[model samples]
Target: MSTGLGRGAGRRFGSGWISGVLAVTCGALGYGGVLCLLFPSWLTTPSARALYPLELVRFLIYVMLVLGFGLGALSVVLRRRKVLGFTGIALATAGTLLGGSSAEIGTLGGTTAVGLDWFLLNLFILALLFVPLERVIPRLPEQAIFRPGWTTDLMHFAMSHLLVQVTVVLTMLPAGVLFRWATQPWLQDAVAAQPLALQFLEIVLVADFTQYWVHRAFHRVPWLWRLHAIHHSSETMDWLAGSRLHLLDIVVTRGLSFVPLYVLGFAPPAVYAYLVFVSFLAVFIHANVRFDLGPLDWLLATPRFHHWHHAANPVDKNFAVHLPWIDRLFGTAYLPAGRWPEVYGISGSPVPQGYWRQLAWPFLR
Candidate 1:
């Protein structure tokens, strides 16, 4: 199958597609942001909400509501395809009528709600960062922003993020219980006592080592491949495509990776810094950008390094996420010197398209 959008992925770029995209993205996410503010205790992640500046968030929502409506109007006037324009306008109008940024906050509750806050913030921030980069230095210039399977990948991103609380709980439950006995206070104190920079490096190294094996196992094991095939099913690669993973894949791999970090007990700040860094790195590797990192590509993971991992021809290789050297050490690295893969996705045993279909796929097959 062609990796291109094929037909009816949406209108051409020169048309109002760009404006419509910005309008709908801003409107929908802004609406979610306002709901997060209004129901901080119920709609937000406690750990994440504490980090956000309420006033700044409120201001951004107000600005986005106006921007969405204005851009939507511009699109409506400029193009015949009024669907995107109309959708943006409706979302913005509804958000404004629902008190815009100043939505009322009632009594707070202890119960954890859906992570609307995480979803909106991550989607907004990552889209803003990667979209422009991809357009500016696209690996495949003809690769449109909205590819054939984009909406499906987008739904995967949305659901994975929206259920952050549940995923986090599940990830931590196994790691914490299985490795609880391994937390040596003396060792934790020593680990924490190390310089913050050193601690951060150690965390990445430890986590990467664990995930490297877990990642390889997914590719090697037959039953596991059934679940992992959904990820490889994407015929295209992009920042968004990385989000197209089986929910169980996320939990198991990340949960196992967390074991080392939790047991060693790195300092919270260092750990938090690692979390921020890893999140960006994960998306960066999957991005559809042409970034020639030169020698650093060998020392660290890069888009080329990762894109090879998803190559259609190279069934199982380049298993490490952060460190390419890990793959080199294990003789599983397949990054052909200075060459990009001709195609992506698996060869046989095709995984079906669409979010719900892919979700139910592993079991049925």
Candidate 2:
């Protein structure tokens, strides 16, 4: 890979842009095809059910097929990067042909549901939103769109998104099994009876407090630190970098965090709302967009607050992911007034570069 550009200097457009477009196109097609063939039951995502009808999604797939072929043809005719363009077209065609035939639509009752469609949709929407935001109000103005480790981070993002079903299952397993023993219908009923606004607040408090301690443990414990360090190894902080997490980290943090929420028994609607809100905040806090939250920074975690957590100069502080007050309360918080870290990433990170390698890294060394 080429050396990453400093602030404001963009990557080489021809190689970077073509490769990226080809990668995303091929990745979507490949994932879509697999879901269609082996896991048709998992195709319908929660976001898809809530947002659009199945027919609309089908129409969009058809449109994508045409666009992919058109782009491939144009690239081949122009004799510019024909290989990538052709590969993208081929994948797109195959995926469309394989997955286009849908017998039924809407949300289906099942034990598993992958967020493939949701992932792609989010990829598009977030790219549209954050790409511009980063470019205009970039925290690191010189950072290129296609940074050195972008592909690795993209793989992490794709895997996490694609394996949403598995993740959900693994995360809920603790809650499911443990809550079975502590089942209290009356407690759940009482909790659900509360106002939606109040329920949301309670859910946030329960989840964040549990996560804060779990996150701290992942840092202080040497064994767990091996896994958590993958998240801190990214040299550049962006919306996508947030997805570079080890599977162990995800399963442990999310699974343990779910315990309190389940035991407390918040309503499904409020729980969903809190999930949506935190999801947005997770990406937002990692985003490259520069903003001054001022007083809000102390109350809530923002990009600036979270960025400091990833800074090489002080890698041990800012363990809180949601509420800054949690960090402040525990005395792990470290934020300077009107300043950003001059550097990011851990010093001499042992975490490997690729997704597969990082997955096995914790077990090895």
Candidate 3:
């Protein structure tokens, strides 16, 4: 209810900034939802399509559109930047005009597609979860959601999500061929005989062990570092920063990480559980929230622990993704009690400015 002006470069927070942001987010997602309905094969993800109920999705889209328009109106009345509200309002209105949730389905099938649905779904979920978390328990209170290079990070996020199909294929192809002979039926049964919980733990250990070396290789190998540097290039560490990884980096690391799991014949369910856990863990370590885990910080990697790895000069401290023990064993662990990095990113800032530029940067050099 406070309509007071905000400080720090005259940015207005109380005067409808929150409403405008929410409106734009909801409006954009709602518009995308309509497009998915109209072209499910080309725009929607198979995982979401198979799992989500159509009626429920339509209802959600309808709700988002209504809220986007209504909140945009409210933001327009209370904010100086009418563009924010108008943009939100326009998106919602356009979705509605294009038939919104009632958009007719095309005859085209799912023979070919990208992950637009995945991007929208993930963006909504990640933002919904992390935005409030950072605001409430922030490592840097002064840090704004839309910080410098945020747009670049966001573009990276969108591109990665949209290419989920490609990444998945590339990751699994070599893995399947290399590990097929080793996926013996008896071995699979023996591995699967273990309790699901135990299997998941093994998956975590295997994944972390494999990723440790792969991650280290990225830093040590100059050519690989060129690609991996795009991830380190993010000057500001946040949840989105983790999503700034180069596509080749994602594919190669993931491909090798899967090698151990696939060769060992872990149950698919356990593998899935580890995948979900790693997804969250990756984002959590890069987040703007810091936790004092006491001695437990040595047992697992935390934001403070990982942030030091992103420090300006020596950006090769922590190498383990989950277990910091790997780093300690390898002599790369660096953690000063109750301290975070004062600065992040590379010293000379060799990485380019834009997403497209950075995509080609590693190759150019």
Candidate 4:
């Protein structure tokens, strides 16, 4: 099952692709800078301050601008990628002119946190780390780095990252309103009194148990299936493929998961730790690399575990996203000895191509 477009065949690194990638990178940085400059209070992440001071982030942005220009110059010198070079320079120049990387936050107070800062930082870091990993140790060696529908998936990634505030607001909206009445201080305190490791373990168990049923519903229920099917429509599974989720799907599933955590009243640190772990694990399970964790595959969901969920032949199996045991308990588990799906995607996908159309699809009926 080798697609000639695999990593071996993708090394040509077409000039057009190079230019397009560079252009997007430069544009995102410039766009992020403008957002920070104009709405600094609303476009920064709260976690960023704990990770690094504002001054350091600003300094790094400046360094990225310098590198952007240098790359642009190298592109032009090579003559093969002049368009990428020039466009990158132009965007980088615009960003510099607008004080995009400037540390000064005049009168904005820089308080209301957004996802732009997190988005850019994560974008750079994830690409730097994962792209090479996928290429070098690909599960499907024949799978290309730039597989079909990559652009659509990329848009999904950008939207989810850039609209972090909106996601948080919508997901937590139910928690804010319902938890106010449902929360039992005693229950919360009891749960929080457990050891840190126990708290973390319990959080995973509770969250994934709820998510397991919610995830299954997305496949069993017709309307919800319409939204979730979009997630499973990717013909090529990779890190970016996990990002191709419908916004409504994200809100509903994530919102559902939040209910238990809030009602149970897990400590703030435990809750935050769970969120961070889920974020990384989500990408890990959907990654293109081959990592069959021998015995752990039965315990934790791996790429193969998730790939089976997305398999066209047996679409309704393996609904558990993190823990494999949930499926085992519910009788939906379908790992057949030692086998991987020959192909991945929806069986008869009617989903449209672009992001907007797919988003509007669920309500069309």
Candidate 5:
């Protein structure tokens, strides 16, 4: 019976219809768990409590993020049933935001810390889930929008976000140690007395500028490109594809961007708010949804705008993340009048076969 089951599995592996049904079913179950189990507990938690409410809300948010990502993975694997995968993602995302807001998990110290932990936990879970899925699914067709090979992309995204969380935690150590060593009485008092809006703006400007340079460096440098290249190697751009970044690249880039915000005496409140806003945009820009931001694209980075940066041709453009003014100032902005790239990914380099190989290849190459 075991041998027969194994043979049956082998036969079913090659059938797109069978795999598509399985993918949609898995996504439905996973997403249903979040809506039915996690959302209510989080929403009903008391807002007056300090840690409990924050913790509950954070957990729910993480569950939603994980579910949305899982649905995205299933979408690619079960290409024939694209609508089911997309609907699952939409439902999970709505549930996550609703649950998070319902708990009133404001960007305070306790809530901020809990949110970071939630992000990291979700990444770990997603990475573990995708490893076996990659082995089971066959490679997708060249021109196909949903690639069965997307398990690698999901793993990359998970690892990158996890690394960013680690970097943020590490930043606290230096901030604490430096405060202990220097003991700046006046600066400490000033920071404590600073207005939240002013402090928030200061943090935003400093972080934006720091990230601007870090993003530019990724394009300029060679060794760094090896790791960063994973993000651009996706033949089909989707929500999961956005997660396909090298862990090392994430650590360095996010660390550099985060450290300045810490050192600049930005209020912790401001940092928390800024991180949430930026994190949402990062995913939004990488998402595969077809929405054109006509005039708004010039003011801020959009999917259509950022997608050009990942294009194989016209390599020298769109390096800035939030503000395009920096790119325009540096003469690196490359968006043409009402046009889009036909192809994306590394033009000549061999695409990595799997997540583990992609992770190791940066060092080995």
Candidate 6:
């Protein structure tokens, strides 16, 4: 009887492993194929004279990212121990691909060199920042962490920033036309007279404020919470977990977050700088790294603070993104002295496991 029970357990484990591997394989292939079909231009290498011609390299890098994510997901599904290692490898490969000369995409001067430098710098910075934390965080319980799939969460995060950047650039076209068609010379002159730094600050502040409100709204509205919950549902809190937001949520929140910055006349350079800085902070705040900022916690957000937001109990606090001041001012701040929630994620609801289902669930419901 004991032998039979052992055999039954072994068969169940084997079956689970097989199912996970198949899911990862199918997800990667399906995602890659769909991306290739939908954005054929993204796969094309531009002419030699093109300022940013890194299209082909970018495509290949994305492929590697997909594969790496697949491997990471597979590791989780199989209950293997190399999930972070595989994810790191994938991130490194993506960095290398973006660092190559062929991955340039914009009219920025010295496109190839600039792209290479930015890619390498960002890769190094993110790796240095998160790799250590990945090492430190305890392995999450199986039920709490989402099993890895196609790394769609990362893709979602990337696409949100990328689309926002692209849209900001496109807005300049209309700004130029308005400049050309303006009936009020004083208005144009007023904008021109504004100091570069002040103008930049105005843009960033506007964007930040907009994002804070949008985030708050997501929590306040039940329908939207369905989409947003996917982000909060991750039982395991880590760098990658920050990328788990649904695409619809990304579009709405990011679009609202960016429009104010664009309309306020924020220079592209300033916007880029702010984004890089905030991106770094976002990763740090969501990371499993242990650090205490003491009084500074009241001023800025951190992992410990944000983790509380992800807690299952008393789900009405910690909605501000970068600044806790907003939460405090609005009476949503719930941090108590020397106390932290013991567990994170939604208490009840049948959440989907894979990226595709999560993406489609909002629409289906």
Which parts of model 4 are misplaced by more than 4 Å? 1-27, 34-38, 45-52, 109-114
Please provide, for model 5 over 173-282, each residue's C-alpha lDDT reduced to its tens digit, 9 standing for 90 to 100. Answer: 55455545555567756864688877766666677678778887787798877778877888666556777777777667776777655555566677778776676667
Q: Candidate 6, TM-score vs. the true structure? A: 0.60
What tens-digit string does per-residue lDDT give for candidate 3 at 1-365? Answer: 22344431134665777788888999999999888888878987776677878788888899889988999998888887787788889999999999988778766564547788888888988898888888888999889888999999999999989888889989987789877876778877899899999999998888999999999999999999999999998899899999998999999999999987887888888988888888888998999996768989988888888888898956689988899988999899999889889999999899988899999999893
Give the residue spans of candidate 3 off by over 4 A.
1-10
lDDT of 4 by residue, 1-365 (tens): 23235432222454334544565475557556655655656877665535757676676667667756776765666544356677777777777777767736644564565577777777777776778888888888877767888889988988888788788889998888877898888988998888877888888998899899899888889999999988988889998899999998999999998899889888888888988889888988888988888877879999889889989897689988889988999898888766889889976667888788878888897
Better of 1 and 4 by lDDT: 1
List the candidates' TM-scores in order: 0.95, 0.83, 0.94, 0.88, 0.62, 0.60
Which candidate model has the greater TM-score, 1 or 5? Answer: 1
lDDT of each: 0.87, 0.76, 0.87, 0.78, 0.59, 0.57
User: RMSD in angstroms, candidate 6?
Assistant: 9.3
Model 5, residue pairs in steric clash: 157-243
Backbone clashes in model 6, listed as residue pairs: 52-104, 54-102, 54-103, 54-104
lDDT, candidate 6, 1-365, per-residue tens = 12134421222444233334433433333333333233334421222224433465355445545555565465455444343434434443444444322333433232121122222224335655576555565333222223343265555554443344343345444435444454355653565467767765665566667878888889889888888888877766667678778767766786667654544545556677777667777777776656568888877787778888988887968877777777888888887765667777788745676677877777775
Query: Which ranking of candidates, highest TM-score first?
Result: 1, 3, 4, 2, 5, 6
Better of 5 and 6 by TM-score: 5
Superposed Cα deviation of residue 283, candidate 3 (Å):
0.8
Task: Quantify how close model 3 is to the true structure by its C-alpha RMSD in Å.
Answer: 2.6
Kindly list the per-residue Cα lDDT of model 1 for residues 286-338, writing each as its tens digit.
89988877977878899999999899986688999999999989999888778
Cα lDDT for residue 290, candidate 6: 60
TM-score of candidate 1 on Cα atoms, chains taken together: 0.95
Q: Per-residue error at 239 for model 6, in Å?
A: 0.5
Structure candidate 2, residue pairs in collision: 6-142, 7-142, 7-143, 8-141, 8-142
Query: What's the lDDT for candidate 4?
Result: 0.78
